[model samples]
Target: MRNFEKNIKNKAYAFQLDPMPDSFDKVMDALEKKKKRRFIFWLWILIPGFLIAGGGLLINQMYSSANAQVQAQSLKASHLLTVLFKENKQGLVHEDKYALTETTHTTTPENKMNNRPTSETQSLASKNNQPVFIKESSNQSAEFNNRNEKSFVQIEEKTNMTQVPSREKWTPIIFSNPYFVTFPTHSSNPVYSRTQIPFTKSTLPVIKSNSHQTGRWSIGIYSDLGVSKNIFINNKDSAGFGYTNARQLTDKFLFSYSAGIQFRYSPVKWLAIETGIGFTHYESNQLLSNAGFSWTTSGNNNDPDTALTLSSVDPQSAFGPYEYQNVYDYISIPIKVYYQKKWNWTGIEAGGGIIFDLPVNTHSYVADENSNMSYLRHEVKTSRLNVFGIQASANIHLVFHIKKFGLFAGPTFKYRMNSMFDKNYITRQHNYFIGGEMGLRYHF
Candidate 1:
């Protein structure tokens, strides 16, 4: 080895290394491999997100289409009524084996004074035709008599009647429902006597419509029922009872509940955003098996008259579980974005968002030192839970729309991405929840 080192040192000034272009290609190849891995990771995340969005949009479209169809049906009914009325005015000839006749005429003082034509009278009747209304002025009288389900109408007018003479050029009038209309607001007032009245055309329009439409806002409230899982991750760098293999993993989760009110607005058809206030309750029965307990006298050292009590806890291992329970309650505010789709009367919705949890209360547990080996009860202690934290969640739901009312139900998953405890605490805790939620909604 000494000979080789000496030979290399003696010839070092005379030797020169060559630079190969292949080395640059190797570095570039490594960079391309890293870029491909990054793209794959992003693709995994994007695939499910797009799927959820597509499903939600399809559901929303269905709901919108269903609502529109219902509206169209109602409009069709009204249009049918209008068409029937129009056909009657146009004197359509019916081929049915039924005869119908209607006669309406009015004579005003002005028309008589000006010698203008009074009115046009038309009638049709066949075998077994039903009797219909006949309206006339006070100067004239109408009598309709029915015998054996047969109808007869007679009108007596002082002036000579001018009837439609040609059936080919005649405009026949039919009345399914007949009644007198009150004088319009712009027309003259009623006589309030048994005198002949003239029909007046109103100058003011009725039932005018504009281009305005309803707003794109809605509100809903919901309550969710599901089980929540608890995860306690140990901080390996921390000293003493750091939650590393400290808990008996027998129990995984406990019952959890949440309820909230949401106010949403949609700027377009397929998308919406909502924000709301929520209340959540999380609990766990998972017991700590390696926790430590200690007792120490606490008092002012300078005062001889004061009494001291056992008041300290040691961060060590070896305490056993006895009647232990962990509970946390939080008030949350959530901001979420949704993708929606609809088909027929049903729709789908997918959403993701962040939750800001403000801790309202909790109960921490300590094992009882004097309990029997079989018992898992604990000594109740003050809580050491976090005051405020954050979480993320994704959810998918099926929605059913019934006019202005709706229903939603689906599964959701939540993860507390950050540790609840700060660096001051020995253990780090994260929570995972997988649950189903169902609720009702109202729309305007």
Candidate 2:
């Protein structure tokens, strides 16, 4: 019995080292196989990641181009409006009926021998009803000396000034109106210099305020890339199976991605409500080690009774380390409230929300010795995962406006509110997602 027990102990020891090959060439071969498997695993992740990133970039470029065009058109319309207003003021002033008049005074000397005002001066004085006066000066010539002769004479003179009407006729230039200015007509068309259209208050163009337009609706498309980790709680049962003198199985963060469409409505200048539906995919890589017990029986049917032996062996050590990959897919619906502050061309938005995560699929893969991978059957069903699967999220966005479109980028954080898996499972896990989100939105 002692020898049989020793043999069983030796066999258990040999099983521990069975997966590690003795030959250097065999080790290299195993390493090469691991490399191939790793390459394929990363390929699966990288291909779709690159595709989603590329698609997002393409859409952003298209939106930017369209936004730039719309901005240019808006600027053009503003400049045209300014020009139209200026031309309208000038035309009104030129057509004004008011005129300015000037008066002139002239004096002519009267002959002393025949001191009488001229008929032309008398006729002008009679029409104007003015009197003529004469003055004597010491420097007057004495040659015609009658001491009574006056040296200076003042005569009332009337000057007829004809008022000339402005020759530039105010022929209404219909082409210069705001309608034509805001929406320019083709230069090749016949230009109408005049129109019978009368100017009225209703026909005048209404100027829109420069304030930000609130109470508007907008639609957006967003994509995010990040890393996620599975946080296992209530893991005491599973922890017992860990390798000797080692901590329990732990998960590592892996790349994750999400894409979705959002709709937003603003009922006030600074507040908005938003909702969106999206697909979120999370992946985690884990190193799992466990201790397992097996029973061995010796002595064949010839013996009345067989000797039974029980042994404990590190399952990970016997079969090589286990590489576990957990993938979760969810269709998420989010409802959020936001507060936004806008500047002339930029805006800031802060929001928090609740998300309902409906499980679409769940998969777990385990890679063993020889780099062979197989799917593990899980008791937690995808349909049951939604029972407590909800998330709380918050984000702050920086938005730049170009015409009717906005470009936004921000950091987003999410915390799972409940266990992602059923609580009855041996290991219950939750997840946290943190990442940068970027997108483009069109405002109406």
Candidate 3:
């Protein structure tokens, strides 16, 4: 605080100065000289070292080659000497074994006792010339060999030959292959007996069958349910029922269903002729707002009427906020032709044909809106439903086959081709239905 600023300027200062530029040049020169000296030293040392290594390897290869040649020659000479020595020894033994001997019988007691030498002086290899080997007869060898080893080398050969089967007689087990070739054998052994079975192509049944495959009969049962619509099918184009055009009545068409049994015949692989009898139930629903639009043709559930004619009477009445049902039941007979195709497990068939239906009856019922439209019924009878009619239909089905039974399902369409009443009858209906059908069938 007293004189700090003045003392700072008076303090001794040190600064490092850069080396002179020439100093860099001197350092680089020294490095180059040092590197050159190392290069020269290694060049002189490596050349002579490589020469020495190369010469030593060459000398070693020459010496090893010469040594190996000498070892091979020595081994061959030793093997030859061994073979010659064995041959000479065997020749000497052979000569000694059959040395010439005079025929003398040692019968006298004095001669026998003198001839029977003992210990080292015995007749082992004396120059007296005696036979040490004997030519063997079959009986002697067999009899003597059995004394200790029980026919060691003699009978053992015959026994082994009898035990082992010969290669020519060996019958390999040809595992049970039905298609294998059978060879004939004359051997009495049961194992060698092979009975040849002659199989001809004519013995096999053909894959293309001629029976139920085509020209056959089949039977089935089917059922289907879907929407139904009734329309006027006349040349007059006449419209009636004044309250509503039947189909325009709110909620006009709901559902129709049928169940039936069918008998079908196939005349060829791809074509079928079928006929069936079935029961059909058709229904239509209509909404009533202004106290039910009525059907004058019906007798209001056959209720008591004051007037003469049922329609002139109280005339069926229904209230608002209710659903009315018009129902028709029919006994249907169908004549159809189908194009059928089949495979191992599944098939498809599609065809179109005509059907005839005889109406069983017609009835009308009602359901209250408060009841969630459940069928609360009130029916009226009418003779107008007995008319016979005809229809055209087409169907396609996918069939799943299991053995003799087949299950089939697909879409079906049918349209009434004719009016369901006499020509003069009013309110003629030609009903048509669209729905899926399923059936079960059996093959013979």
Candidate 4:
């Protein structure tokens, strides 16, 4: 054993003295070197890289500006060229059409014959440098000749003049002329002129008016489920037919269902209000223990057994354990004004409001035969529960948009402001309660 101990000690000593690098020291050296490279190398890389990026951005902007200026100049030149060409073409067309029209008109002479017109009278007329002769005999006379000469002179003097003369004899017929017509034979056609149009202000296409604006009001059913204390306890030692004043009885559930109007204001989404009357039901159950201490004054019946009962050493033996089931049904009117910030029509809301409950009724079921099953019921009948109440709860809502309707489902916590059972029961010992509910809501 001594040798064994010495061998172990020798091995331990060898291991302790071995020359080896500590992992912590190596790690610290590596970390320090990495930190040094990170600061120096990263800074070196980032400074140059950022400078390059900024330079590239500046170059891009300069190039874009130059290109835009060139494009603008080109567009302006093209527009001016188009306008000039259009005006020049229009003016040339107008001049050509007007010249053609002016050269196309002609004039003609007119003559009217009476007696000579009864027969086929072939007359010769002269135009330009051609001569036209009529078949009137020279055998008429000098007077007739003179008259004919005079008429010829008159006709030659006024080329476009109109004359009216009556015809008498065939040997030397006097002609009646209504108009003088001069035919040009060749005339140019009329020309149509087109004028250059001036530039007018240009406008982009305008879209028609929009028809997408809308206003909406919805009808819906809203509900809340909550729980509140039935009786607020001030002193723990006080006698009562409910949970001890020290340890309070929590309300299980006060669920309400109502139908009301829902309204929405646009631009501010997820904001709305609901108003309606609801049927609210609240129920609670508790186990109550009766105190066996009793006292009677000396003025009572002087029977010996009565004295024994009054002065009993163990008064708890007179009663059995019992359970109480409390139920409250009320017609509640709830005006809940809630606001919601919705994410895709699904969100959460927190609201609190007053619930006016006309206590329809309250019933208590005693667990044992010795229990005064009608004690609490008789009290309710005497004074129907007209209680002012308040409930506060938060709910996660799922809004389903089906055409113009909405369906929602979520959990809610509702509490009655006042206790269901009048805790001031003269004969009951203690009251305790616990409950929960589920509900649905619809919107239109």
Candidates' lDDT values, in order?
A: 0.46, 0.47, 0.45, 0.32
**TM-score of predicted model 3?**
0.43
**TM-score to true structure, per model:** 0.45, 0.47, 0.43, 0.35
Candidate 4: tens digits of C-alpha lDDT, residues 1-444? 699999999898788554333556657876995796567446545543554455445433332223223323322222111100011222221111100011111222122221132122123223332222232222111111123222221111111111111111001001111111121212232111111122222311111110011123455555433333344433422543323321244233222233333333323444555445666555554433333421111122334422223113224333312233456665666655555644322244444345556655667432111121211121244333335444543445544322233445444445455544344432222222222222234332
Better of 1 and 2 by TM-score: 2
lDDT tens string, model 3, 156-225? 0110000011121211111111121111111122111122222232222101112242227889998866
Candidate RMSDs in order: 21.0, 23.6, 41.3, 36.0
Which residue ranges in model 4 land beyond 4 Å of their true spot? 1-215, 222-231, 236-243, 246-268, 288-319, 343-348, 364-378, 419-444
Off by over 4 Å in 3: 1-211, 233-241, 244-246, 249-251, 288-318, 365-382
- What is the per-residue lDDT of model 1 for residues 130-239, given as tens digits with 9 covering 90 to 100? 22232212333344434454333433333211112122222111111221211111112211111122212221101111101123577888665666776655435233
Best by lDDT: 2
In what order do the candidates fall by lDDT, top score first? Answer: 2, 1, 3, 4
For candidate 3, the clash count comes to 0
Q: What is the TM-score (0 to 1) of candidate 1?
A: 0.45
* Candidate 4 overall lDDT versus native: 0.32
Better of 1 and 4 by lDDT: 1
Tens-place lDDT digits, model 2, residues 127-242: 02121122222211111112333232222211111112112111111221221111112222211121122233333211111114422799988876666776654434332332
